[model samples]
Structure formats: structure tokens, C-alpha cells
Target: MSIPAEKVRERLHALRSRMEKKHIQTVILWDPDNQYYFSGFKAISYSRPIVYWIYEQQTAYIIPELEDLHAEENAYTDSFHVYHERYNKGSNDTSFLDPFIRLLQNLPSDTRIGVEYEVMPAYVYQAVLDHGHDVVDIGEDIIDLRSVKDEEEIKWLDEAGRLSDVALDASFRHLKTGMSELEFDSYGDQAFLQAASEKYPEVVVGYENWTCSGIRRSAMPHLHSSTRTFESGDPVVHSRQVWINGYRAENERTFLFKDQATEEQKKLLKLAVDAQQAGMQAVKPGVRACDVDLAAYEVIKEAGFEDYIDHRIGHGLGLSEHEEPYLRFDNERILKEGMVYTIEPGIYVPGVGGFRHSDTVIVTADGSRSITHYPRSYEEMLIE
Candidate 1:
């Protein structure tokens, strides 16, 4: 289990406390990440709804019969309201909401319910209204609590960081001149999956962003890898993310392909590394999140590449990949200890290649600690 029953119970206790403070009689969670965070049950809900409804003193999971067995063993709460096929053929009267309503049989009609409206499905939101329950948006509270990583969560984040670096090392070993981006990507994925499978085969090895090559088309950040082969000195902006349990971490490095790189290529890559480091250094308790972003942005801006900056420094990464405490100029949220996020500063020159170095880091009491420890120096990244 990703989170032990005791840990899950502890989290539930926290939620109950928040509910008491807010006068929330019940809190219904529809977001998969939220569902996974509180309960250990992981499932995507759209048609077949998987809900976690917690009242002041009661907690139960209204899940589909298909996942009943899994939830029985994994979920922290024992009160499961499992339902079979409620939508029989085209009968709208017997929709999945019917089963959900049954789960709330004990809930009072005037009970103040809390929900994550922004991420909750429209169908589920409407069902709550139809039931005429008093609902309040508790999205901010949920986001606030999730931003801070607990000890166990930090452990998984570290594991993800270690395995991701191993995968990148294997990819570099397999890399050669004239290799196509797609071919190299396959090898990189294989390495990541291999490392993850050895410990937990069910763990997912996937990237939130594509493994962009520094070749012609690779200058475009977020572009999918094509058949373009790496030449002698191509600067490939490689970024990857892997998930263990429910936590994820990313490791990105700009590699100098089999051939030697140009002076300009080396210069830009160094700047990117420096900018990323600056951003990471700016992370610590009490500092504003935007300061971290500005720290990196200033590095690029001072280098006369302000226009090359396209996106914010980086965002928070956790259960859903991108969470709150976003590192951006407009966001003034104070950085707190135990908050883990990514700092990726890049300059994407249209004609030339792009240079980006992303790392998952955590805010500490005194400073910051990088979970992703892959080498970022020009010497380590610039391969021959």
C-alpha cells in the first residue's frame, strides 16, 4: 500500500478537524487524486463513480463493484458502499446516482457538505444539488493540506527521483549518433520501466512531458519526439517523470549528443543549468513562491534572453503531477517547509535549440533539498 492504514487514518483525522472548524457535516470527494490521497483506493471516475464521503464521525467509500475487492484490501476505511451496474441499458431513472444516494442514507438532509467543485465532475456536482444537500467549496483547504508532503510521501518522492536518474543514465548509454528521437525515447522508457518494475511492477513509468530532442523540430518545448535523428552536436532537451505509489518526480537534462557541441550550445546549456539552480536555491520556508520563479527568470532576463522565456519557472508536482503553490510571478503564496515542487528554467530559441534543466526539489526548514540528483554540469551533460 502506498499509504499505511494508520497514515490514512491520521489524514482522515485531519480532514475531520477541518470539517469541524468549517462546520462541514460531510465532505464528498470526486477528484481521483483527492480520492487517492484520503483513501488508498485509486480509480478514475466518470461513468462508474468512485466516491469518498466523510461526515463528522463517519467515513465510507461508495465504489463500483468491479473495484470492490481492491478497495476492500487497500482502502483504509472498512465501510464500503459497493454498487453493481446501476445504469441498466438506457434507463436514465436508474443512473449511477441512484447508488450514490444510497450511500448517503444516513446523511441528514441539511448536513453542510464540502466538495472540490473545480475538479469534481459535472454529473456528480449536479447529483449533489439534486439531493438538495447544503454544499460548500472546500477546494482551498484540500489543496493547502496536499501541498505539504508527509514523511512517507517524501520517501516515495526520493525513490522516484532515484529511479528516474537511473533511467536517464541508461538512455545516455544507449544513445548514439544518428539515432532517431523515437528510437531513443523507446530505450529511455524501457530503462525507466525496468527499474520501476524490479521493485513494484504495478508502478507507472510515464512522463508528464515529452522527451524533446534538440534537433531541428526539438526546439519546440512540449513537442512529441519525431523521426529526426541526432547529429554530431545536437543539444537534446530530455525531460522525464516517473510515478511510484501515487507520488511523481521529474528529472530533466540537456544532453550533448554523440558528437561535440558548439560553443553557443554549451553556453546556453550552462545558463539553463544555472537558472534552474538559482530557482532551486530560492526555495525555503517563508519565501514567496514567486521569488523562486523570479530568481530563475532574472538569470535568463539578465542574459538577454527574456523573450525566449515562454512559461513560468515550474509548478508543483505530486499526486496529480501539477498541484498548487505554483511558482509564478503572479502567485504570492509563501513557500512552506515540506512543500515539494519542480524548478525548470528554459530558453527556447526558435531557430536554435532549446535548453532546459528541470529538477524536483523540496522546501526545507533552512533551505532546499533536491530529490532529483542527476548531474547538470556542462561536463556531465555534454556527452561525446
Candidate 2:
């Protein structure tokens, strides 16, 4: 189960308490992430919108009839309102509005429905308005609720971290001087899928793995895997996504060839690693997200290479690889316990190359704990 029954019940109770306090009659959840967060089921349909309705004391699902069986089998809901229609013989029918209308008509009109306005389609919004129902936009409220993870989410994230570590280890082991960039990424991709299978057995790895080598690698933050061969003196950057129980963890690393890093390269790597450490150390309850960015920025600036430091230190990692509570220089969101994010500080020198060190970290009541365990020191990257 993505989320156990007991945990789901607890979350439902909490949500109910909040709803009652706000006097919200019902919450119409359309965001897939929110759906997966509240219920453990992953919706498999893209043809129709997946809607979850949460009342003060009852939880229901408004899904396509085609997915009713799967939702019943996998998703935990107190009630189900399935919508489907049989097509006329030899009739061309591609729209799903009729069934959707039926589902909406069933909902109470006097109820103050809360919709995820940020993610709901304009047509859906118009439909809701046309139904003469009172609606409230609670998208930010939902995001705030999800920003602080529960104990069960933390447990799953910990497992995700371990799976990512295994994939990174496999990638590092396969890293050699003459391997093509695509070959290196292929090694990590295979390793990620194999490791995820051992844990989830049903999880599918995300789209494409990133692996870039040489000077051009510095330009692209999300480098696509390429067939270019790795040179003896080149720098390589790689990243991959691992999913376990529908939760995601992304990790990246930059490797310098053995005996090939110049004095400047070594110095820049040291500064970047030190800056990353400072940023990670700054994570704590009540600290602003930008404070963490400044912690690293101060370090890089003190080292007289502030201009070279580019990009935010890190971002929140959860169902989506990049989510809320971003760690950037201008973001003012305060950090809180149970919020997990990454601290990746890099120095990209145009002609030479770039160096970056990243790690996933969870803010604790006291300080923070780094879930990722890859070595960031220069000595750890020596090819032996």
C-alpha cells in the first residue's frame, strides 16, 4: 500500500477537523499529487479528470467508471461515485462531459465546495460555476498542508533515499574514462530500475536519465543523455530519478577525472562542497528558505567566486521531484520541521566546466538530517 489504512484514516481525521473548523462543506481535489497524498491510490487515467471529494466525516471518489474497479481495489475511500456511459452502436463519442455533469449534479448545491483552482481546468471551473454552487479556492491551503509531511510520508521518503543511494552507487561503479555519456546514463538507468524493482516491483522509472560530459555540460542544468564519449580529463554530471511507493527522490553528482583536475578545478570543487555543507547546515525550524541560500552565497562570495555560483541551492523533493518551499536567494518562505529539500551548490566556469554537490535533506525539530549519503569530498572521487 502506498499509504497504510491506519495512516490514511489519521490523515482523513485531520483533514476533517480542518474542514469543520473552516466550515467547508466539501473539498474537490483535482490535483493528482493531492489525490495521491490523501489517498494511497495512483490514478492511471489521463483521458478523464480524477476527482476526490472530502466531506467532514466522509471520503468519496468521483472517478471514471472504467477505473472504478481499480480505485476500489487500490484506493481507500469510504464511498465511490463512479460515472460512465455506454456508447451507442457505431457512434463516435470522445467527450466525457455527460458523465462528469452527472457526477457534479449529484453533489449538494448549498455546500461550499473547495476546488484546487490552480490545477483545475478552465472548462471545469466554468462547469462548476454553471452548476450554481458556491466555490472557494483552497489551492494554497492544500499546498501548505502537504508541505509538512506526516510520519508515514517520512518513512517512505527514507526508503526512497536508500533506493537513490543504490542507483548512485551503481552509476559510480560503472563510471570509466572512455565510456560514452549515454552509456554512463544507461548504466544508472538500468541500476535505478533494477533497484526500484527489488523494492516496489510495480514502480516505473521516470522519463529520461541525465548524463553530460565535457565543457558543454555546464550550460544545461537538465542535460539529456548523449552518445558523446567521455575524455580522460573531462568532467561528468549525472542525475536520475527513483520512485518507490509513488514517491520520488532525485539525486545528482559531478565527477572529475583522476589526476586530471587542475588546481583551479580542485579549488572550485572545495568551495562548492563547503558552500553546500553550509547551506545544509543552515536548515532548521523557523529558518527562512532564502537564509539557507544566503549561507552558501556568503561562503562563495567570501571565496571571491560569487559570480560563478549559479542556480538555487536546492528545492523540495516529494511526489514531484521539484515541489514547494524552494531554496533560492529571493524566496521568503520560512523553513519548518518535516519539510524535506535539497542543497545543491554549483560553480559553473564557462570554458573550463562546472562542479556541483547535491544532497536531499529533511528539516528536523532541532536541525536537519541529510537523506542522501554520496561522498562530496574531492578525495572520494579519485579513480583507483
Highest lDDT, which number?
1
In model 1, which runs have C-alpha deviations exceeding 4 angstroms?
A: 44-47, 86-95, 103-106, 200-209, 258-263
Cα displacement (Å) at residue 52, model 1: 1.2
Give the TM-score of each candidate: 0.91, 0.88
**Model 2, span 1-384: residue lDDT tens:** 667888777777777777777777788888887888888777766877678878767787777767877788778888866555555523332345554566678777787778888888999889988999888887777667778887877887787777778778877888887788878777666776777677666554453467778877844667677888887667677776666776666677777775776677667767877898899899999989999999999999999988887689988888877887789989999999999898888888887778777788889999999777867677775453
Question: What is the lDDT for 19 in model 2?
Answer: 71
Off by over 4 Å in 2: 83-96, 199-208, 258-261, 382-384
Worst 10 residues of 1 by lDDT: 87-96
Q: Model-by-model lDDT, in order?
A: 0.80, 0.77
Total colliding residue pairs, candidate 1: 0
Flag clash pairs in model 1: none
